[model samples]
Target: MHRIFEFDDIIYAVLQHVKSSGTDLVNVAMTCSRLADSALNILWAEQSSLAPLIMCLPQDTWEVTENELGHIVHFSRDPTPIEWERLRKNASRVRRLVGPHGFTDVLKLPRGESFIPDLDVSGYVLQRLFAWSRPATLFPNLCELHFDAVFSLLECSSKYWLLRKFISLGLQALRFDVIDIPTHEAEQLLATLPAEAHGLRQLTVSADDGTMALTVPPSLGKLPKLIGLAIFGIDVCLTRQTIANIQQAWCLQSLKLKLCGTSCDAGGIPLELPSLKTLHLSDGSLPQCTHFLRQVTTPKLSHIDIRYRGSASPAEMTAFIESLSTSCQTGGYLERVHVIDESKIPDPLLIIPLSSEIFRPLFKFNRLSSVKFVGVGNFNLDDGFLYDVPDAWPSIRELKLTSWKRRAIDSVTFTAMMSLASRCRSLQTLHLTVDATQSTIIPRAPDGTEKLWPTQTALRNLHLGYSQVSEVARIPYFLAEVFPTLFDFKWYDYYCGHYDDPDIAMISALSALNDALQELWALRKSAGDHDLDERWEKDSDDSWT
Candidate 1:
């Protein structure tokens, strides 16, 4: 009796369900001679998932023993040479392999001996696989690689040599996270690399403390195509010097500096960069920042973003911005300054006075287009001098104000915003944050009603900072009443309570707002189904572009 088989349909179904490695197809083909012949030339072993299948085999196949299997079952639990070879043949598709456990303990080879037995186990497995599959040439298609920074590799002579050989491949991107290296060795490795390797267009060097400084090679600055440079943990002074050392890097356009030591002295260094367009400075100390400003002279500079620790007082922050504006006037064409936060330090006495002085000069710059203040509190706008801020920043296109303290902003206090809207007619975007904690201090609008923010003629983007998720639920009404032309809106929960503990209440509020938006979107999409009113959908649809 002949059994019927749906060969084409079976093949299609097999391909559809072959989500794991091709190991399943190989096993199925082994069940029958006919199946094996049919599956020939399937190229199932070329599957990308093959390496994981091979790596997991040692954990599942509990049949290899050290004494019984000799060399064949070296990695297997219960030495079975024939079975090992069968598994090896099926698993050899894996060109590159990673071990679950890294090499440790130096593989303790006997003195003067060429090889250690367990070390040979790893090499033999890889060698047999490579020999059977001819994977050496296959690795050219591979461009990314990852490896655990094994501790033993640093001290083990054999492993260290092998590591060097393994990593010298033509890799485009390599990320070695938290791989502790001796300071001297790390320095040597970086110092010895030839700068002419044209393939490495982007390089990231990161370390956490004790690892030696991963100095930027002077040769790297000379690379014709290098455009991005990110350096972390170097001394602030050293970082400025290194950047100055590569001053003529015309290709360099993006820079990110997270300096660790004392801020560099700007008195001696002439801040200068001719081609740089983007600069990110994360310096915690403001006094050190003056030096940084003195060194930057980007004629085409369009963006400057700052992130520093919370130690700068409002006064010092004012100085920092002044120095930045001064830098642009001297050597750069600074167009936009985005301070992620103004108060690098929490000293309030410095913040209030600094805000007054900075706002006065800040409003005078026509080249400055946008300013974003994160975690900035203090300065009473009710004061008559504060009313001139909007006019002072005539060219200001976007303004973001985030509050760390709760204070009442009365319509009477909105003279600055009104002045900005009326005088600095160039203002197109405004982001405002109001801390609800000052509810008790800031007198409520009459009759228990919420007051709408002052209206602006050219407002397009508006962000509201609310104290709670519940407060955000009132935004649609808030926007409709005060900002009819608003094209974009975002709300952030500025958690203002003292507990500082994990507060799920804030998370729940955010989740609820997210759910509300998702539901609104779903409703808008379904409006056409029943010929229900679609005006809301059309009205809410924004087409600013």
Candidate 2:
């Protein structure tokens, strides 16, 4: 251990690859005060409730007793000057909190921010403590405050005053986690946000689903540093004026919201977002999505993740796609597009088979690398679409088009899928549903000689989701012919519920495909192939987990 200080460069090099956790980390932390302090500081930072910290005051300062429901904490008496100073010093170190739990109820504060979460801290005790300091001791330098209460703050309530007190200019993030505020009150709180915290960067207001209609206050857009915003609500949340104001936000980059039901007003000024890059919308109808796409022009946009919660006609889908194409400037900058249909229940209106024509608008974004569409499947993908994809997205890496429930929509075939292998040379992960009912077909030349089919050597994973596959015995060879370097071949069964129970047929199919790969890997391994192990260490996977 003394050698750690002797050679600092050697220690740095050794520490880079060392994996330490649990008792190993605890034992190491116990060796020094600095490491122990850091570990305690991290644990105390995310403490969730103030109950634990409040107890650290002088022994007689707070009394712990029991009630009908649970234990409670109340001030025994006023803290003396020295005791108060001791409490203040320790409490000030808390930078962020994610709770209020049962603390507010015991404090007799239905709306008071003073109410501690998950603990029965007395109301009178908090009132006296906060009253002692104008800015409030608990809130002086809090960068983040997350409330778990279903609180509604009326103007005269302590919750409102405490909320205002907590909203200092230094605060960076705030979240309303537990309660879904009514439209008027939500607007009131949002309206007050910018005035208090001009440096606020991220804001999240969550509800169960789209049941609550939350609107963005125009004042929210005035925050100079506000970059990320996610609100779970219906279409009414994004008013025309709100959308217009959002376009003018040069600092804002990512926005996530759900759209559904009716909004009396739907149009927004055609405003441009110069720095906007990632936009995610879910529970949105096709018309509303098309409307949303028409409202904003984001030249720097790279990723668009959207979900159709219910139904849409082919024309509506096409119109939405067209609007999306127009909204994003397609000088080959767009990188990812994920379109999903979350309607688990089947609907006659939702039985719209997806055609390549609906996606043709995206051809302009030639640099698109990752494209995914799930459960919007009733695939009618044509040869032209597959043939043109390599030309359209030459550098494509991941393409997933899958539908598990509706096996009735499979039209794409193996021959058509093979066309992509020649051009999309860098393709790695593919999730496509193809008509594999005729699984015995072999690739042959025009003159009838046995021809070698084009194989994608870079392809690692092939996910055939509920696609028809007969003659299972011969399918492995067929897969090996298409993807020579494939590491995982999944046919008919998709990987969704991999842990709940084992499927016998899925296991059999996986084993057969793996056997086919063993022959393919035997030659590569003899030549020193360690691709699989090395590929797992991606640049983004920096943490141990």
Query: Candidate 2 — which residues are off by over 4 angstroms?
Result: 1-30, 34-40, 55-87, 99-136, 149-159, 177-185, 207-212, 234-238, 263-269, 348-350, 437-457, 470-474, 481-485, 492-545
lDDT of 1 by residue, 86-149 (tens): 5443343323233323222212223375532332233434434444443324344333333332
Please give the TM-score that candidate 2 achieves against the real structure.
0.74
- Give the Å shift of residue 542 in candidate 1: 20
Best by the TM-score measure: 2
For model 2, what is the alpha-carbon lDDT of residue 267? Answer: 71
Using lDDT as the measure, which candidate wins?
A: 2
Off by over 4 Å in 1: 1-138, 142-179, 210-215, 263-267, 329-336, 341-353, 359-370, 376-398, 408-412, 415-429, 433-482, 485-545
Give per-residue lDDT, candidate 1, residue 401.
62
**What value does the lDDT take at residue 385 in candidate 1?**
43
lDDT of 2: 0.65
